[model samples]
Target: MRRGLMAWDPQEVPASALADRLARLRAELAREGVDVFVAYTNIARGGSVWWLTGFTPYWNEGLLYAPAQGEMVFATALSKRVAEWISSVMPAGEVTTTPRPSAFIGEHIARDGAKRIGILELDDFPAGHAQAILQAAPGVELVDVTEAFARARNDSDAVERLLLTKADALAQAACGAVDVSSAHARDFIAPAESVARLGGAEECFTLVAGDLRSSRAFVRTDSMGSLGETFAARVSLAYKGAWTRHVRSFAKDAGVQQSMDRAHAALMDFSLQSGETLAQAVARTFGSLGEVNNWVAEQPRGSYPLAPVANMAESAQGFTASAPFVLDVELVTDGRRWVGARMIGL
Candidate 1:
């Protein structure tokens, strides 16, 4: 089980270096018998949309059409100059602009009207937008190719791996910052004690945020200043693109260390028992009710999910962090030495 978890690469990711993901997607599309990879409208924080088209959306929606068999193209609500700039990098066959992504998609679907069209990031699609795509071709089969895109897009491509490496290097440099800065000045580099040392964030000004999928955990600490209180967290592991980041924020208190010790132990224990790959653990915990306890919660309600923390170590380190010990807060995929816990200052 654990054999496969460490096999995955824990590559870092940058906002840039998302371009080559298309080639990988094209290959997956061919394997899966997809005709056209339709990337409609929104290019949220994920960076896949811009990778597909080289143009990021400011506010409106757009479309990306990548034929598994032929040239790639994109349509968006942008000026010709911006579109040309995007096309210059990716070498698209066509770059069409429209006020809305679904409208552009409807137009293109009307042109090809193929039997099956692949759609990525449909979660971002509004109900109104989905109807427009249906109207494009009544007989057309709209397949939910989001996972296919995720697999292809998230697979270790050359360029993306490079970006991941760059991100990792930046983090590594940050990790060493403690050596350069004095103890008093360590806050500029990172907090010396607390969770900063334990599988922590690298930057001094690190932040954590999540949306509908993970906003609860983020909001608990960020929105409500409540810490050290019990809280409940809901995380869906089945998600591929959902993201959450962590900052090693610990209030000045003794309990922080105690909570950190227990959290670390729990992380180790769960990893050992799972006897699964990163993929397997993900398949199991995703959409499942995995409980987290032992540490103080950032929320007055519950603890943050640990699926990310366990998954990342299992995904990157291969060994369990707190195997055969305690079970608390299963990380969905971000790390917090004490990121999830706010010390109940005594």
Candidate 2:
């Protein structure tokens, strides 16, 4: 469940922005000859729904039904007591609370006589929901419109970029709040989460690599004792439905700290040029600093908030120069392992 603040700030996200996004998706559905487009959203997979409707479920699951024209309908199992809150924050559609959300959506489809229904991430959609839809509208063709949705949402808009920048700033501030003098991993996690929550984050996840020398694996455990010679913390934060991650490394040794600082500087200066792959960008920026062991670029795709789009050893897929992405880099500088991550492309 989300522990932080969850309120719609019209100043941050104007209603016009949400309307524009819905219009784009509707255009895509029309092009595909789909009568309606349905997107499923749970706590884990709600990025697409959030992008289109500006509504991220704090808990439970829901289905967004967007007909070729007219306003969309959001059907959820959440209690009616919270319906007004959801409607207030969600500026794009009608909110309908039902015990059987999928069946409600299916009934709507049948009423409309929709012949071709488009579903986002159909393979991952709940089977119960699919069965309910089929039961309501038998023989209605269900088309997987994940790719079509991607085409509609592939580009990053100015409002989203601004929100990403704010989210990244929150992550950075949260990471910076960690007390380097702290003795335990839990100590580091505390300040980071506190800062993020105070900054109005919808959700905050803090991961720690207690000892970079022994391991570079970041985990969400408080069992570790004492900070090693070098430690790293990664803060993933969501603000107003926009998510971004920031990772920082800490070291007791002056030289190690300097190396980590230099690595971060290079990351801040890094940018993907025209026609350059993510690997090429990483090489250009960090090759001089150290041996680039690994790097991964992630972006919001399908229902995932941070889906991997590229890595150091492979070709990038669905990478766009205009879209924002988060990049994590791991490298060895003078035999010391250093890992850092930040938002790229603004």
Candidate 3:
């Protein structure tokens, strides 16, 4: 569950911006001959809904229904007591809280004689909700519109870019707050989480790699043993509805630290141009720093908050230029491993 600030700032995300996003989505739906579009939202995968509406569900789950011409409606399983609060944060035309949100949405859309319903990430949508919708509107044809939704959401608006920048800054500050001198890995948790929460993060997940030599896998724990010669921490944060990640590594040896610092400088200076692939971009930036062991790029796609779009292993999936994404890299310098990640593409 989210444990930090959860308020909507109209100054940051004006109502007009939300309306424009909805309009673009509806235009895509029209091209697909879809009468209405439905998107599912949970605490885990709700980027699509958050991109459509300013609201992100802290717990339970919800559904967003958008018609071709009318305003969008949100139905959630949350209690009625929080309906007013949800409305204050969400810019949906109607907000209803009920035990069975799918049934409510099915009945609501069926009343409008919706002939073709478009579901985002339909393959991964809950089976029970799909059944409920089919049970209510037996004649309505349900079609998968994940591609359409992705096309509609491909463009990153200025407001979202600003939010992502703030989120990345928060993650960097949180990771920077860690006490590198501490011997125990547990000591790194409190300072990072505290800084992120105090910095207006809606959610923060901090992972610590006690030792890079033994393993590079990051884990969330408070009972870690003593740190080794090399340690690293990764902080993933959500500000408002935008998400970002930042990773930092530490070293006990002065020489190793210098090498890591050089590699990090290269990462910070990296940029991808219009016709450049991620592999080409990495090689251009980090070719002289060290051996590029691995790299992966992620972006908000479909229902996933951060889905892998491009990676070293899979070069087929290309990334969009000037779109917000997180790039994680692993470098090997003189047999020493250094891993770092940051939000790129603004």
Candidate 4:
């Protein structure tokens, strides 16, 4: 049903901030010879839309079409019922609602006289929708510009950092709410949900595992599982345009705790050391711990936002001192000592 307890501050990102973000994107598009930039979003990728427009679509899917020089138009599949809310944040005249969203978007593209267009998430965009845009703008050159936008979104602004700090605190609260004594996996869900909602989280994704024998992967607690002397909980919460995740575990054995201690040290050292890209740190760490599983050891340290879930195995080349990131360590050794997990933002 409904579970977010924390209400978002009614205050929205200032108009000037949004304008500056858009202006930066438009400038990037111009450098790429891209006439129009299309940003697509669904519930999962809602942060991308909010990054530029400061409005997160509640129920329906939407996108924004920003030309090199002109007003940005927001189009959605939702009707006027929710359209009003979108207009409140953006330009009312630029908001469009239609059952045939492709045709509506295509018509706008044609009107803008955009030929060299770049569509974010072009590979994932619906085939029917792509066809409609192709039909509207005959011989249009649509490029996949997701990487360009991702680059811009990599670093957080001052406003984003503030929001992320709040989100991180909310995640910590959610993790603290879990009661390992409860035994039942489902028992933790209600408390976690309550904490997140109270923290004004727009979304809460909670997973729990009571299995203690081996390191249990976090799973949605649709059905209860036994605690078996150990348990693990992972909670991810989204507030505003930022997300924070916390992972906690309880172990009855000292060996498991020791393993976790070692992993934590390595993770902290790797995360804090400056100058190494995520990929380099992973390789160096794996090389040092030759006996450890590279798959498990090298993962859990990667980029934040733009890809909220860390691609542990993937090597990230660029390293920025001020950019924010989430560092996690989930370790299992020789199938004997298993520590659940832990996450922190840096």
What tens digits encode model 3's per-residue C-alpha lDDT throughout 1-346? Answer: 8768998898888888889999888899889999999999998998999998988899999999987777788999999999999889886568999999999999977898999999998899999999999888889988999988888888699889989989999999998899888888888667999999999999999989889998889988754777889888899989998989998888878888888788888878878887888899998988887798899998998888887888989964746666888999998876888899999988
TM-score to true structure, per model: 0.51, 0.97, 0.97, 0.81
The true-versus-predicted C-alpha distance at residue 342 of model 3, in Å, is: 0.4
Q: Which stretches of candidate 3 lie over 4 Å from their true place?
A: none
- What is the C-alpha lDDT profile of model 1 across 1-346, one tens digit per residue? 0000111122332323343556677777777777777765442332455445433444455666776555566766776566655454333347766666566676666687566777765565467767877876567776767667656644334543343333333333333333222222223333222232232322122322222133334432234332332222211110112112222222233464454445434332223223555344433433232333222112110011112223333444222322211122333322332323211111
Q: Rate the local accuracy (lDDT) of all candidates.
A: 0.40, 0.89, 0.88, 0.63
Q: Per-residue lDDT of 1-346 in model 2, one digit per residue for the tens?
A: 7768888888888889989998888888889898899999987898999998888889999999997778899999999888999999988889999999999999989988899999999999999999998998887999999998999998889889989999999999999998788888888678999999999999999989999999988888655667899999999989988999999888988888998899888988989898887888899999998899999888999888888887876657776668999999999886788899999988
Off by over 4 Å in 2: none
Q: What is the C-alpha RMSD of each candidate to the true structure, in Å?
A: 12.0, 1.1, 1.2, 4.3
Cα distance off (Å), candidate 1, residue 150: 3.7
What is residue 159's positional error in candidate 4, in angstroms? Answer: 1.4
**Candidate 1's TM-score:** 0.51
| lDDT at 157, model 1 | 44
What residue pairs are clashing in model 3?
none
Candidate 4 accuracy as TM-score: 0.81
